[model samples]
Structure formats: structure tokens, C-alpha cells
Target: MAFSTITNLDAAAAQQHSHELLDRILSTASSTYVTGPVGQGNGERVLVLGGTGYIGRALVPELARRGYRPAVLSRSAEVKNEAEYADAEVIVGDATKAADVAAAVKAAPTAVVISLLSGRKPNDVEDCRQVDHEAVVHGIKAAVANDVQQFIHISDYGVYRPELIPQVYKIQVEGELIGQHHGYVPWTIIRPTAYFPYLSVAFGDVKNGLKYRIYDHGEWNVVNPIAREDLAEFIVNQVLNDDAIGRILPVGGPWNADNTVTLKQAGEFMFELNGKTPDWEVITMASWDKKIARLGRLSKLTKQLKPVVFYLEAAKY
Candidate 1:
């Protein structure tokens, strides 16, 4: 069975949705394989696209621990964090391009492919489409060509509720991943809600003499949050387990998100963590624009990045 909770979808929709779930598992005939070589070397081999990012840094090592030979598709020749790079063989290439993906496939045959790349910025929207949307299709195509059996797509907060984004990208990623490609490769589409580790850092900065600001009233229910370590562990566990194939695991951590914790409690946590009290103010839609003005200055953020913090301010997360 696929890992998705979207079981209510009709037949046509179910299979399409299920394809994303299938990519999550390790479906080889044997659950356990010998460490060295079990006659023919059928152990799972994985291709981790975008192995240098935060999630990738955490994931590749876990994948390695599972006995999967995880090779990385690095856009650059050398990875900045060599410790993360140590767990996997690095294949230098641009995942957004077919040629580069083809090279990655050539380097790792019958590999399960996982992409950590996402479109994080406005300028990178085109690139995100190229990487997140198109590259996924092409990567699966390449995997199928190479007889690779599994594909995993990790969609970030930006794909869903990005702080300042226009909000059309969710449909873009979902539509692209769901269209065609059945019978191509077993797949998993993971849409994790807001991330907490990064938030810890962002909020930490705000508490540490770093001025904090919000978008509107930090109103909407704070989104689901999963720790970086937990997410890595889930992906690793799923990738090597066949039962997880054809599943879309929508994972979130417990109490990782809750507005129930009042501002006083949140403030205390942040202040304690950072050793400095934060500058804060509750806002409303009427004052949203004005807040952004003062906020941009207070955050000491750049023109392209003010939205990230402002968005966080609105979050009770």
C-alpha cells in the first residue's frame, strides 16, 4: 500500500497519488542484505540530488548508515561541508538539466533518487521550476532509462506556505509531479510543513539584540514542524524499506507546532536561549504594511530576504 493519507481519491487519482508514495520504500526482494556482497550485490544504491544543503547534510549520512550506497549530485565540483560529503560519492552536475541528470544516473545504476532541491527565491522561481518541477520529471525519466526503481521528491515550506510568495507554486509542483510518469518509477512526494530547526535559529537571532517583527497578527494556526533530524531519520527509514514504496508520508513532529504556548512562554524560550530579550509587537492587517517598513529596518535584512523574518513573526510556530 502507498504511504499517502490521500486514500479517498478515486481510482485514477489514487494511482497517480500512489506513485509518489511508492518512491518512499525499499522494495528489493530481501529486507536484509549482507554487508559485503550477497552473491550478486543487490543492496539498494541511492542517488541523493542536492546533497550539500541543510537537509541533505543530515540525510546522506543516515542513508549511508542504512547500507545504501548513496551518491550525491552536487552542482559544484567540491562540497563545502566535507563531513556530509564523506558519506556519499559526489557526482558533479546540474540536476535541472537533463545532461547532468543523465550523468548522475550513469554514475549510479538502479539507484533510488531523492531530490532536496527546492525553489526558495523569486529569482530562483524559474530555476525552481526547472529543478523542482521539470528536473523531477527528467530525473525519473533518466531513472527509468537506467532501470532505477525509486524516486523521492521533498517539497519544502516554500512549495506550500512560503512567507512572502505569490502561492501558485504548490499547484505547479503537485500538477507537475502528478501528471503522467506512471509506470515510470516508484515515487514518494513528501510535503513537510514549516521547519523548526531553522526557526530556532531565526527566533534565536531576534531574541539576541536582533530586532524582531511580524507580517500581520501572527494569526493563522502555526504550521506543522518536524525537526531536521527527525525528517532525515524518516526519509532514511522509508528509503530502505519496501513497504514505504508508493507512499507519500506527510510527516510532522509532536508539539513542534502549537499556538497554545502564549507569547510570554515563547519569549522566555527565545530570551533564555539567546541571552537577550527580543523586540516585539503584535500586529494586525491594518498595520501590516507599516510594520514591514519598520521591520525591514529592524531585521537588518536585505531587500530580497526581509520577507523570511517578517513571515516568521506572524507565525506562532
Candidate 2:
């Protein structure tokens, strides 16, 4: 039996091509070994939402490497060019729209549906809610409708104690996702600590010849930030390990004292990586408070600053 790749198709063509791809994958009589919660099996079709995003880009290829044919749903046209998706089937569609999501879900008899969707913009809370919460809800419904055996969700550790308003939406979405996982279908929620790439935001100031900014006197705060590739491997492994089912795993970087690094240390490391010396300034609590007060509750700056504030607060505990 021979296999083929599908690309750059319209909605109708994409749906038809998806079915053909699934039929080809499922028709294979030979069983390939797979890891994680779904156990070793044949004819396992995995559907990935947000497969074009950071973790998804790594995960789709990882799934393909593990002998599972992963079909990634994306809303972008550039998915055709992404080298990471070369091994997997790419479906162009919106996860937020029921018709689009249903089409993807119905494309194959999916054994597992993994959602890596999140808001791309930091300041847009509404868009975050739409993608993180509403679109996730849509994906869940579609999975249930299609009899998907297991669902794996990529959530943030910030959902543990959601203090910031933006984080509350994520928490809410987590609840809704878990609540919807009833009957025979089980769910696994992975709440990973900060990604190493997220720390690159501090580099923005450096680009303007400004010193790296730290909150609260640059005191060392231990945070275990995982690499996106490592996290992708962990997520895929969950699909083979039944122990992960019906559990919310709070995963960090490798278990080591070195895995934990303060933001100041992280900044210094970033500087060293860029072949520069560390030059950082501290934003005292008093200064932060004054800035917050001046911006007022309704200010866009306030919303933008809240995550930084929350991170500082979290570092203390």
C-alpha cells in the first residue's frame, strides 16, 4: 500500500482529502507501536488543534515519529510551507467554528484529540477567551460527537491560582473542558510551567538599548521552565500511558535544582546567549504600585502589566 500527502485545499477539497488520507492510514493491516494513554495499537488517528502554534509544531512531527498519523487543523495558509508539518496531514480550518471543527473531527475515526490552542496576542483578552475557552469548547463537542476515545489538553500552570483577569479565562476553560469529559471518553490535562521562550519578552527592552527589567530587587525566584520540544514529547507520551488518563499533570522541567532559575538568572543567561553582559534594573514593588495606580483599573496598560505583576507575585510563593 502506498501513502500520499494532501496540501493547499479549499474547505470542500480539504475535507475530501482528509477522508482519503484517513482511509489510507486506517486501511493498513500492519500494526505499529505507539506510546502513552491510548496504548499500543493499529489504526489510531490523532487530530491536533492549533497544530501550527509553538508546541503543536513540535508535537505533530513527534506524533508522526511515533507511528501515529497526525492530522493538524490550522486556520492559516502558510501551514503548507511549515517544514514541521511535512510528515502529518494538514487541514485548513477554524477550530472556533462548529462546521469547521466538525469537519475535522469527522475526517477520521479519531482515537485521541489533542488541543494546543491559545491566544496569539498578549493584550487581546477577548480573543484569548474565544480561542482558549470557546474554541476549546467547540473542539470538545466535536470530539465527543466523533467518539474520540481520549482528549489531551495543553493548559498553563498559571491556572492553578488564577489571580490575573486574563488567567481567569484559562481557568474557566480548563473547568469547562474537564466537565465535558464524561461517559466513556477520558481526558488528560497537562498544566505545564512557563515555557523558556516566554521569557524572551524581556529582550524587547534590550533591543532599545535598555537594561533588562526585573521585579522586586532581582531576588532569585525558582521557576522550572520547560523547552517546547521537551513538553511536546511529554504530551505525546501521555497518549500511550494509561496512568495519565483522568489526571491533571503539573509538569515542570527535568527534576533538578538546576531546572529552577530566577528571572534575573534567566535574564543573565539570555544576555550571555546573545554575547552580551547582563545589565538589569529592578522594578521595586513601590514603583510598580505607583505605576499601576497611575494607569487606573480600566487602562490598557494595566491589563498589559497584570501578567508581569502576577509573575512577580507568583515568584514569591
Candidate 3:
């Protein structure tokens, strides 16, 4: 009977089952569950790594508005004069360096440290390792050494099925925190789905009469991409809260007609927004898979083909 059940499981069912099992394991091994909010921040200093990017612009201000002292670590001092960072104390440091991360943590009495660090180049493996995996390890070590109350890591939801290089690194960082590989610091791992900008990348092309490329019927998966502002609010809500400690929260926007959509549906909506007939450049999954396989072989000989393969893999993801 067990063998029969295992054989009958479909791909989607297997994926869902895997996620359920992983969640149960993490929850049991991490911390005991607690209910209710633990009140507001009382002037706790929050050191935000990677706070000069898209989500950071919204999160820093939100943290300040909620009575938390927001300190942003940026490589550039010019951000200090930026209006978005007006409420934040800008600390000049590079996230890729362990010493810089440690100094930034010890520079002030940091109560919480949030790592929003991700690689800018998803196509580069070395960059992903340095920024996504190694940089986060730096923050984890710093947070532990400084005795920070909480370490919140913003991971990708796609780590559940890590097909891309960046996703693999995100998974590794998640493991380091959950296993206490570096040291013991109360941690919250948030796996957020695609952002609005990511899903809307093709909007401009579609508006300009370019065919929106998609695989198979583009109905393979459905996602509800969240806005940066909404995601920032959610992240702040988890800050310094006992209920959120040692939790793996998979977050997205509201599940409604407007938000929840398949890739094909997303493309159709873009066409409607631009008042144009939908012109899709649909490619079969079998052919796309073959192309990826061919490129995978070529990447071994030519390093330039690596990024091309990465992009193809990411699109399939």
C-alpha cells in the first residue's frame, strides 16, 4: 500500500508534500509556538543589511514610523542625503565583507539585525555565493557575536524547489540559521514570492508591441506577487516579536482575482492594460527543456553561455 501511494503521487503533490514535511521539521526543531503580538518596539535599534535597494526604501521608513531606531548599512555615504533614508542612520559598509558586517553590528547596540541581502546578478554563480550565501553568513556571525535579540532573513519562496543558483544559495543560508551552524541567535526566515516589479518586467515589451514569451500554455504555476510596500510592512510586523521567532513564513500578496494569476493570465492582463490584442510568443516546455540541455553542455566549454543558461532556467522557474 505504501509503495502504491508513493507511485501514485504526481509532481505537484510531491512538491506540496515535501514543503509540508520540511515545515513540520523546522517548526519542531526550532522553537515552541507562541500566540499574540508582543506589543510595539520601544526604541530598539534595528541594523538593516542591504538597505539601499528597492524594498529597503519602504522598510526603513516603516521601521522608523513604528518607533524603531532604523540603522541602514550602505556602501555609499551619499544615501544619507536621500529623502527615503532621511529617517535612517546610514552606516557605510560593504555587506560582502565579514569585517565590515561585524563592525557595523558592534558600531551600535543593535537589538535586531535584518538581512535583505541578495545577489544583483542572478546569472553569476560566484556573485551569488559571495552575496547571497557568504554575505548572509557574515550577518549571522555578527548577530550571534553581538548578542542581537533577533535575526530576520529574507529568503526566496523558490528555495522550496531550488532550480536556480541564487535559490540554492538562499536554501544554504536558511540551513545555516535553522541548524545554528554559526551560533545561537533567534531567527525568522521569511520566504517571499516574486515582487510586483519582477512580474511586470514584460509589461513594457508588451506595451511596445513585442511578443510576451512564455513556456507551454504559461499555466504551469500561479503566483501572487507582493508590492514592496506591503512586503515591508509584513517584515516589520515580525520584528522583535516572540510569536514570529524561529518561524518560516511564506508570504505573498492577497489571494484574489487581481493578485492571484498564472503566467498566461498575467500576460493577458498586461495586454488589457495597454489596450492591445494579446500577442504571445509561446514555446513548448519540451523544446525549452531541450534548449536548456543543449546550453548546459555548451556552458561547460564557454563561460559566457553560463549566464544565458541561468536566465533560461530562471524563466522556467
Q: Which candidate leads the pack in lDDT? A: 3
Ranking by TM-score: 3, 2, 1
What is the clash count of model 2? Answer: 8
lDDT of 2 by residue, 158-245 (tens): 7776644435666676677667643345789899888855566667666556688776545324566787877887888888467988
Residue 176 accuracy (lDDT) in model 3: 89
- Name every residue pair that clashes in candidate 2: 35-240, 36-239, 36-240, 36-241, 37-239, 37-240, 37-241, 38-239
Give the per-residue Cα lDDT of candidate 2 at 54.
77
Alpha carbon lDDT of each predicted model: 0.58, 0.69, 0.83
Q: Rank the candidates by lDDT, best first.
A: 3, 2, 1
Runs of candidate 1 exceeding 4 Å displacement: 1-43, 122-124, 156-171, 196-201, 216-219, 256-268, 281-283, 289-317
Q: Model 2 Cα RMSD, Å?
A: 16.1
Q: Candidate 3 local accuracy as lDDT?
A: 0.83
Cα deviation of 222, candidate 2, in Å: 1.3
Name the candidate, 1 or 2, with the larger TM-score value: 2
lDDT per residue as tens, model 1, 205-254:
77557755432333223333566766777677667457666666666554
Give TM per candidate: 0.68, 0.76, 0.84
RMSD (Å) of each candidate, 1 decimal: 11.7, 16.1, 7.3
